[model samples]
Target: MKYSILVMASPTAGQGSATAVSFARSLLARGHTLHNVFFQGDAVGNGLANAIFPQDERNLVGEWAALAEQHKIELILCISSALRRGVLDKVEAHRYERAASTLHPAFTIGGLGQLVDASANSDRLITFGH
Candidate 1:
């Protein structure tokens, strides 16, 4: 099966995003394909590269990045939601004259159309959030 995951939960505040990652892992383990993981709303924070977590806490962003890297899957963040929350990629940062981009290299900033395309192309569209 091909799956597209939509995550709307805050990366640091809740379990929804983490649960999505775990589910993605299980799907891969079962020989399924991940079409894309779309980070919408607060979940776009998961793509921020500079987030600092407590030493004892799980680095959820890192986990997501590693998962994307290991599986070679697309990790797409909603450009609108991300920019509103100060999560910018290099191109967007330069375009908006920001000091620096905080987006992780493992993820790419895309418009909502990507989410729609992923949903249309994938066999399943699973969402995790409030």
Candidate 2:
């Protein structure tokens, strides 16, 4: 089945993001097709370029990024939520007069329209953490 994911929790908030990652991987392994993952709310932290996690702990951001890379999935961060949380890409950072880009390269900034399009295009629209 063709699927898309909507993640709404921060990686550090709880296990919501982690669970989403695991679920996504499982679906793919079972022959599901995932092309888009939309990160909104605090979940946008998953696309932070400078986040550092301890060796013992899981770096959820990197995990999600790796999944996107390996699966050819589009990791999209909601532009409104991203800007509100200071997650800026190179173009946005420069446009907003920021010093540099703070968004992970694996993810792209997008509007809610993309979310709508994903929902319309995919057979399953799975959501995590509200």
Candidate 3:
């Protein structure tokens, strides 16, 4: 089956992101295809390039990046939510006259149309929330 995930929680603030990551890995290990992983609301913060984690803690951002690279998963961050949280891509940064873009390499900044398209294209759209 093809799966699309909707994450609605911050990576560091709650278990939602972790749960989503685990689910994605398990799905892929079971030979399922991941269509996309859409980060919305606070979840968009997960794609911020400036996110720093303590040395003692697991690097959720890095883990997600590695998983995305390994699985060739499409990581889409909601542009509206990302901007409101100060997560910007190169284009958005230039347009807003920002110092630099904070969007990470592992994710793409996209509109809700991507979400709509993923929903229409996937066999399942799972949501991970609070």
Cα lDDT tens digits for candidate 3, 1-130 = 9999999989988798988998999999999999999999999988988889999987778888999999899999999999999999999999999999998999999999999999999999999995
Per-residue C-alpha lDDT of model 2 across residues 27-83, encoded as one tens digit per residue: 999999986999999999999999999999999889988998898889999999999
TM-scores for every candidate against the unseen true structure:
0.97, 0.97, 0.97
User: Which residue pairs overlap in candidate 1's backbone?
Assistant: none
The lDDT values for all models are 0.93, 0.93, 0.92
**How does candidate 3 fare on TM-score?**
0.97
Model 2, residue 18: distance off in Å is: 0.4
Q: How accurate is candidate 1 locally (lDDT)?
A: 0.93
At residue 130, give the lDDT of candidate 3: 58
Q: By summed lDDT, which 10 consecutive residues of candidate 2 come out lowest?
A: 121-130
**How does candidate 2 fare on TM-score?**
0.97
